[model samples]
Target: MSHSIAHQARPGHKRSEDGVLRKLRPLFWNQEGRLRAGYRVIVFFLLWGYGPALVHGVVDRILSLVMAPGGQWSFGIWLDPVRLAVVVGAGWLTAHYIDRRPFSDYGFQFNRDWWLDLVFGMVLGAALMTAIFLVEWAAGWVAVDSVFYSNESSVPFGQALMAPMVLFIVVAVAEELLTRGNHIVNFAEGLHSWGHLPAVFAAWLLSSVIFGLLHIYNPHTTWVSTANLVLTGFFFGLGFVLTGQLALPIGLHFSWNLVQGNVFGFPVSGKVFYATSLVRLEQRGPELWTGGPFGPEAGLLGILAIMVGMLFTAGWVRWRYGDLSVGRVRLSHCENRLQGR
Candidate 1:
């Protein structure tokens, strides 16, 4: 595969006349004159791994000088933005230089169609979460304790509610960019020679596995939770695979976390949000059914929700576009440039 790709005549790539340059080109570059996919992936991971630690170290040192000893900042409020910056910066750099493509090619075009799909995704996510809460309630598995409760007396009510909202929004964008926007696009592009449908499916499945593994170390994580998260990744990627836009996935992700942790007071992926919740509740159902401390994503109900989400996403795509086919996720850089994208 590598040998074939090295020799293929890619559009816009002029073969070097110099013997040394020609010989070296195949080693470091593809037929398109861009860094090969494997090398690009290596550079991306390196930036993602080290950039956060370096930035955090410098920020921590600077904060230590001004703040009192042992004084702390909210993890969600403070550190999340730093992570967002690092992740977005890494993705932009990789797309612009290593991939030799427009950053928006990764399904982030801010057009009317994108925004409409985003709204649909957000509504679907909220509706699904509400269904989960209602189902548990009907089964007598959950008991509500209060509404608009805050665990911290020092924090104002509005601030408590707003913090998690901001956190989830930032989290949604960053995670979707890394997991769906960057990983899937690159994977599909790298595998384009395998054929479009095969490349898209393979890339989707591979990136979803990575997404599940990413949450393996979260608080109270279990095998069941991890497996369910793999399904969740597929659910989130459905819209992207169909429409090739990040808006749907991002909106769905944000609303799902916000409504799960803040609105209904569920432990989101095992991390309990103790600060504030609109409807505090206790679970009395069996752990297997209710997900216990790991939230719904660890339970059967979550799997059901994921299936429903996939169906709804497909329906939306069919309705909006009058066709239900995979988007051009496997379009290569040369192809994109020729189309003037």
Candidate 2:
């Protein structure tokens, strides 16, 4: 009689434990036994925010041990790479451990098609900047101050241009990885789990808004600039949504900044690069049209460029894919896992 009673109590306790787990699972884990999208996003951001500072501190300390007391380090050269590594690690860890997916699933599978799209994006970006430069020049809104100008007398012209090129490349890759690759994908997955189609639109809009907000503290930022940056984010995200690849956006971003600030001598989002430029230009047009010291991004001309770019992006998608459609933004992998496939 006592043994039978104990056995019955053990089963009852097991049932109670199972009930508790079922109740608590939804808070942190999805049905697939992976961390919920929201929690994964939170973890990714926490890593992104704090990982860089921690790594940088360690790096500085390591360098200090090897260098003279007063030796100076060139921050511009190393800062971007360090941040890039941190962000890449954050994304990788979040995808592998938390999201239960591959990091390449975040739109970075490099292949022939990806490279082709990237080249096209770069050309398109360069063309758009060239058009802007021509229009401003034709309207007498801009004046050429010098050619192959370097603000730093000690840095050679080639070095000046090369430095900014490398910087812009790093910036393009890092920003796209964090903004479109991680944020948009994660937001879409989270939202999709709740509602289907509306989630896609909401995810895009939210990510773009966040992208703009990230630049809120940039030099000479205004409401108009912020709005324009949001629009710019949408433009950058267009190719990603259509093709599920970062190649287009990353290439476009690189060339856009490279041409805007380094080639054409416009202030990149209001921060003038004092390093070097192929041409030094002076703005004489109305601030409303030219974006003034804030550069083209703050003005009507920038808006026009962005509109044209959008049309071009849509056309490219239609041409390449034979239709304009959203890619794997729905995150079907989670469904596959849930189905045990």
Candidate 3:
């Protein structure tokens, strides 16, 4: 009698543990071992939103007290690195804990394969951005100039190289961690199977569009510039989908900006406008072709170039990573399992 009672109690204890596991499921489990939206939102707010603002306040006050009589602090270079580290680490760690995801899922690994993909993607992305510049020149929309900035001072070749590297880490790793890693996976997991793709695209659009809009305050932004940004977002999102890995898109993004803003001395996605850029332009032609005050990115040629790039990269990713089919590809299946869990 006693033995039978003990056996029955053991089964009951197991049931309680199972129940606990089920409740904790959402915390640890994600679709395809990726982070979810809840995790991303919390981290983004903590790092990008609040963290930077708070740090800025501190730095501003410190500068006010310590600056030379007429010297004003330029927070551009100083604040950027701080924000980059905080935002990237916060997003990564938050997803790891809250969504119960692995860091590799966010493309933190720097394996040979990843480096190869990065190099390829970077080259490809730069070519596309450059093609737009060429079209603008051919159409007589702009006259070429060697200097992108009025200032003769070089930005220290070392600084130019290092800046883009940091920017790449923030843009690629941080953005991937927040959007594709957590937000996309979460939506895919939460929604019905049939709704997964739509959900993913919707999230992609929202995230990408927001990214462009945020740059509105950069330097010279206009309606055309903003539109081009939307296309860029689409391009970036497509890369994320096609590769099923974040590193490729990051590489592409870094290269695009490096070439546009640093190498060519052109506006990056129509944001930063310097006078003496490596690729200089004097707009003597049409606004549509030249991108007007918005930079080259505003032109029709710019949009076309981006679309071409998107299609080419998409094909490459498909060739390398396999077709984007449910279960056939791991990322496609991630959202499904996350929803189930």
The TM-score measured for candidate 2 stands at 0.86
Which residues of candidate 2, in runs, are more than 4 Å off? 1-24, 57-75, 193-196, 336-341
Query: What are the Cα lDDT values of the candidates?
Result: 0.82, 0.82, 0.63
Candidate 1 residues lying further than 4 Å off, grouped into runs, are 1-28, 60-75, 335-341
RMSD of each: 7.7, 4.1, 7.5
lDDT of 1 by residue, 1-341 (tens): 98778678553255334656778789888778888766776788788768877987887676667776434434456666786799789889999888878889888888899999999999999999999999999999999989888876666777778778877887788778877887887777777677667777888898898889989999999899999998899899888988888989999999999889999999999897655888999899888888888999998888888899899999999999888777645467574454443
Cα error, candidate 3, residue 212 (Å) = 3.7
Compared with the true structure, the alpha-carbon lDDT of candidate 3 equals 0.63
lDDT (tens digit, per residue) of candidate 2 on 1-341: 99999988998999999999989989987667877767777787788778877988887667667665433323445555776787788878888888778888888897898998899889989999899999999999999999989876666787667667777887788778777887777777776644545666777788899889988999999999999999999999888888888999999999999999999999999897654889989889998988988889889999999999999999998898798877555375655343232
Candidate 3 lDDT score at position 304: 80
RMSD of 1: 7.7
Q: So what's the TM-score on candidate 3?
A: 0.73
Q: What is candidate 1's CA lDDT for residue 210?
A: 85
Deviation of model 2 at 180, angstroms: 1.0
Find the number of clashing residue pairs for candidate 1: 0
- Give TM-scores for every candidate, taking all chains together and pairing residue i with residue i: 0.85, 0.86, 0.73
